[model samples]
Target: MNILEVNNLNKYFRQPTEFHVLKDLNFNVEKGKLTSITGKSGSGKSTLLYLLSTMDTDFDGSINISENEIKGKDNNWLANFRNEHIGFIFQFHFLLPEFSVFDNVMLPALKLGKLSKEEIENNAFELLCLLDVADQGKKKASLLSGGEQQRVAIARALINQPTLIIGDEPTGNLDSQNTAIVLDLFKELCKEKGQTILTVTHDEDFADRSDRIIHLKDGRIVT
Candidate 1:
């Protein structure tokens, strides 16, 4: 089944002569599969990702996610929908330096308020363990190495068990070893838990390993 559908998407920049970025893009991402979106710089890969994440609304088209039409929703509704159904991982870990690793991971769940504090804490610990960062749960986020911090960020993204995980160069800052660790983790998430992942990446190897690669060129799907 398709968990995401984008139809007739068009985006443009009004400044400096109304440049068109994406052109009539249409695609469907299957449920429980890992998909990668790849393109060279300026090909509109990141722009497409931002739209897919529902964080960019100034576009023309329809985006249906998990059976809901989300393209026209207001920011307030989109924010709530995003919190409930989507998790994001960016190139930067973006953890609060003063917060403990556990606390950092628990923030989303707390904002979600769907479970008790104890339950959220337990869930965070489980995710941290899954990411192999459970041992650093009590440490301030700033104290961890870059790799460790990334793992914590992943755990945080998983805390709410979102239906879809959106990543933008999730391993961009990591070394080779850490990159391998993250790649394996994403594979495991797909194979073991049937999680759906959509990532925008420049890493060829990373894109090669995903279940599907949606290659874009000049704002159009090339593959």
Candidate 2:
């Protein structure tokens, strides 16, 4: 089944001048699959990801995820929908420095309020274990190494078990070893939990290993 669909997407930037960034893009990402969006630096790959994640709403066309049409939705509605259905991992691990690793991971679930505090804590611990950061749970997020911090970010992303995990250069800051770990983890999530992932990456090996690679050029899919 398709977890995401983008149809006739067009975006523009009118700041300096009217410049078209994305042009009539369309695609579908299947459930339980890992997909990558790749392109040259100016090809709008990241813009596409922002749109797919429902964080940018100034584009034209329809974006449907898990049967919900996200285009035209208000920011409040989009924010809530995103919390319930989408997990995001950015290039920078945006953890609260003052919070413990466990607390950072549990924040989303806490905001969600769908589970008891105890249950959320348990879930957070399990996610930490899955990411191989179980021992860091009691440490301050700022105290962890770069790779460990990224793993903790991944754990936090999974805390809510979002139907789709969207990543923007998720391994950008990691060393080769940690990058491999994250790539493997993404594959595992798709295989074991039927999770859908859509990531924008410049890492060729990362894009090549995904189930599908949507290559863009000059704001259009070239493949």
Q: For candidate 1, write residues 59-141 as lDDT tens digits.
A: 99998899989877899999999998999999999999999999999999999999999999999988988999999999999
Give the TM-score comparing model 2 with the true structure, all chains together: 0.97
Q: Model 1: clashing residue pairs?
A: none
Worst 10 residues of 1 by lDDT: 63-72
Write model 2 residue lDDT over 143-183, tens digit each, in one string.
99998998898888888889899999999988899999999
Candidate 2 segments exceeding 4 Å error = none
TM-score of each model, paired residue for residue: 0.98, 0.97
Model 1 reaches what TM-score against the true structure?
0.98
Badly placed stretches (over 4 Å) of model 1 are none
Candidate 2 has its poorest 10 consecutive residues by lDDT at 154-163
Distance from true position, residue 185, model 2, in Å?
0.6
Q: Which pairs clash (backbone N, Cα, C closer than 3 Å) in model 2? A: none
In order, what lDDT does every prediction score? 0.93, 0.93
How many clashes does the backbone of model 2 have? 0
